[model samples]
Target: MDCTTVSLPFEMPADACNVHLHIIDPAFPNDGKAASQIGTVETYQALVNKLRLPRAVFVQAKPFALDNACLLDAIQKFGPDNARGIAVVNNTISDQGLEQLHNGGVRGLRFSVWNPDNAVVSFDDCAPLSERVKHLDWNMQLHMGAAQLVKWADIIRRLDCKVVIDHMGRLDPALGVKDPAYPFIQEMIDKGNTWVKLSGPYLNTKTGEPWEDATRTAVAIAEFAPERVVWGSDFPHVTEKIKPDEVVLTEMIATWLPTKKARQLALADNPKELYGFV
Candidate 1:
């Protein structure tokens, strides 16, 4: 069941980078809670080696809240060239501290508005936080479902910095194309001010594996605006019962892309641009 030990089923262009992955460490102080608790930095490095991608972005785990010590530690170990970090922050984070995070290879701040249990930053907080980091040329990453996206579309439109929306935009299966969020997400992709991750189909799927309904959204977006889409493994997949085989994930992404060059672009070039990787 371990992705780190499984052989890659499909060949990935070596130049590609993984845009989403979490390194959860339970040792960090939380509100008496534990993180997803995956293997350590060395173990993650092993998964990276198996995948054969040198660049990755480590998203702060939900359990860790604002304490990014484990995340910071990994960034230092991986060095700025190979790793970028997405962090969580409260309203009080100082400008100097932000500069330090940037210097240490952190490129973006993340907020969660969907999962109420793990939610730290509220919608009211996004504006000021967006304003604060707008000057850093950093994006504001969000882990929210489609309903949340549509509900907050007005303000999201006004963000000074770009936005990176997670998990194939995670539209509800029942909504289909008629979903209001679909068009808005399309608009963001069309406007070139937003990017979405083609990751974690299992979480939002009803039919499973290939995620047929989710595919409807992802494929359409890829065809509509290939450049605005990127791929991620969401590795060591936290809190799910049916563990995903990385090979299946890779194959599924390939099908969504449907061409060698398209896969290459989504897997490598697009991520390099969004993540600032050389």
Candidate 2:
């Protein structure tokens, strides 16, 4: 996808932030997954520049697992002022280690329960880790599918810090609001401590690009918690065999957030609060 040729249907606020994306550098050791050819700081910067988003959050990619060297390096390269990270850390991390990560611009911990065998942090680690980071004002970012959402509802409700659900709770868009897990997600949002990333429609969408099926789910989530929703490109889109055009992905924000005010909140204001971006 040529990002340069793609344009947004509506103008984004100058402070707009892409709250979800990844930067995979081969310089760091990997978890043996095939590295994405286009996953790099330079390529991501180009995409964000083309989309006019000045801020970004470097999510810990699956390939790097618990070793955050690549994630930290990307954050350093992007500059702390313009970037923050969500790292994959376990319960055994020392106080000083957590402090170092916090100082290095990591504001949250990510727990991936979607792929259990490969998940660095399991459901059992979430609560204890959340308690550990509560004083730092860090949030827990959960990357899980619909079944996991339902399976982990109790633990999710008891989390000590704020929670961010990755990829619209990984719900199947064809089911729209009727998806069994939708109510559980809505319940979490109503608690006022949970935020949802309106990202990765491609991950669950049965329909192709423009992703009309997924749009329903995204809009439903945005409407349910306008202040709690944020947008992400899911760049490099590693899980897919073919990448979706970054341009089209950026423009989809127009449909998810239909008004300038809504866009401002999701793209700019919401991220600042969620990520602690100055």
Candidate 3:
């Protein structure tokens, strides 16, 4: 619905501060407060200060995906200070409400099972919330499809912890990414404790230059192990009808990594060492 109309070709580096970004509008409300997409959080912080993003990690989509807590107090009040979060689990979550969302900088825990009638959590009840979120080291954000990635690949291989298969694994680009579930995400990136997010190629490109099927699936996932490839700009892109503009999603990530040192290690040192962002 004119979801932030997009159009891009360039403009991102003005001495880009190690390309920092982490925005989440997973419909941004969970009843700890806030809505109207939280008044677009100053219009997504003025589009990350007009795309000179130095740091941003605002997230909120599961304060038990909302029945009341006012969207987790409006994501702790319009999330900032390099915000970071991801929540939503029920079974009356306790352990002090998961240690008050792990001291309110939640690492991760999103599960959607891609429209099992808007599932809140499944994939076998996410192994006791992945065993109480593996004692708070979190990370279990699945949005599966790609034939359910080898039927949840042994529940992401016996859930020993750490996992984040969001967009890439949704690969289908008309089954051209050598589909066979692309070798089940190349055996979960050769089991070096999985992590992935070559961010949603417009929901797996039915065509419209979603980086031409996400640039050969991001060079076959940076040759299947570029330190567990990471990238994101899914910002405010909920239920897209073609909405992705943050300088054209950073020039479609420099045309999907067309160099400039693999676009400064996939947009600044691989998500600052995979979300430890410093």
Candidate 4:
């Protein structure tokens, strides 16, 4: 959806970077990639200008795993001052190369266990890689099916660096707040190292837009760990059959939080801290 169609509930902070964005280039071969959402530095810059949110965190989409050229290029094109990235790397990468990535504005590493077609890293690599990047102060971020969160609990708990879980732990609505998964996440948050991305209600929702089920979970997270909560547009929305308008999604976040102070923290302050955005 275009920016003019909807009214934003609160004023957007000038430098707010939508926490999760993917830069897609057809020149790169994405192995197991499905969505046709093609975004580039140029289009994204226009988006930033129109939205007035000056920064963005770029996650290397699955299709381009191991080949970080596109992701790095966008970060540079967007200017490291306003763009940061989460790259996908395996043990094969060298220490100097990693330092290069860090110097180039990559602040995190990602693993996607939920979608095998898009996944490049194995469960075995989580801890080792988590250990590898700890020196850089980089967080380990991953996306997995909800139930599988239980399997990796111990590994995540042992990480020396911070961790980020996408989409409200991908919790199933059927699982009440008291479920083992939420408690595990609560435990992580209590330890002060885990942050949750309030994103993709369309990914977890059964009822569709306005996704009350996912909304409740996101709001609960904001309440439970406001400092650890951050928002994402999941821009270019590759997963959905029909993309939800970004404007509506932004409005949904504003409505969910309802107060200017809370929304500003979620949209800008918290993200600036998480991504180290200037």
- Largest lDDT belongs to which candidate? 2
Mind giving the per-residue lDDT tens digits that candidate 4 earns over 6-109? 34667886677687888987766666452366877787676666666678889988778688888998899888888899988888889998999999899999
TM-score comparison, 1 vs 2, better candidate: 2
Off by over 4 Å in 3: 1-43, 48-74, 79-84, 87-94, 97-99, 102-128, 131-139, 143-152, 156-165, 168-178, 182-198, 202-210, 215-232, 235-278
Could you give candidate 3's per-residue lDDT for residues 1-278 as a string of tens digits? 22343444444442232211233333643434333223344566566556555554444443335232433443455453355556657656778877777676666667767778767666676767878878777777777887887776777777777777877887778774788877877787687767777776777777765558666786677656766766667666665655765566666666666556665665556555545555
Candidate 2: tens digits of C-alpha lDDT, residues 1-278: 35573556998898899999999887789866635544899878777767788899999988888889888999989878999999998888999999999999999999888988877777788899899899999999999989889988999999878899999988866787788998998999899888999999888688877678889899988988899999998888887788887777888888999999999999999999999988
Residue-wise C-alpha lDDT for candidate 1, range 1-278, written one tens digit per residue: 25453454456776778888887666666554454456467767776666677788888877777888878987877667888999888778999988888887888888877787668777677778889988887888878888889888998898988799988777886665567788998888777779988887776678876678777777877887888888888876875666776667766766778877877888888878887887
Off by over 4 Å in 1: 1-11, 31-36
TM-score of each: 0.91, 0.95, 0.32, 0.93
lDDT of 1: 0.78
lDDT minimum window of 10 residues, candidate 2: 30-39
Best by TM-score: 2
**How do these models rank on TM-score, best leading?**
2, 4, 1, 3
Number of backbone-clashing residue pairs for each candidate, in the order shown: 0, 0, 13, 1
Determine which window of 10 residues in candidate 4 has minimal summed lDDT: 1-10
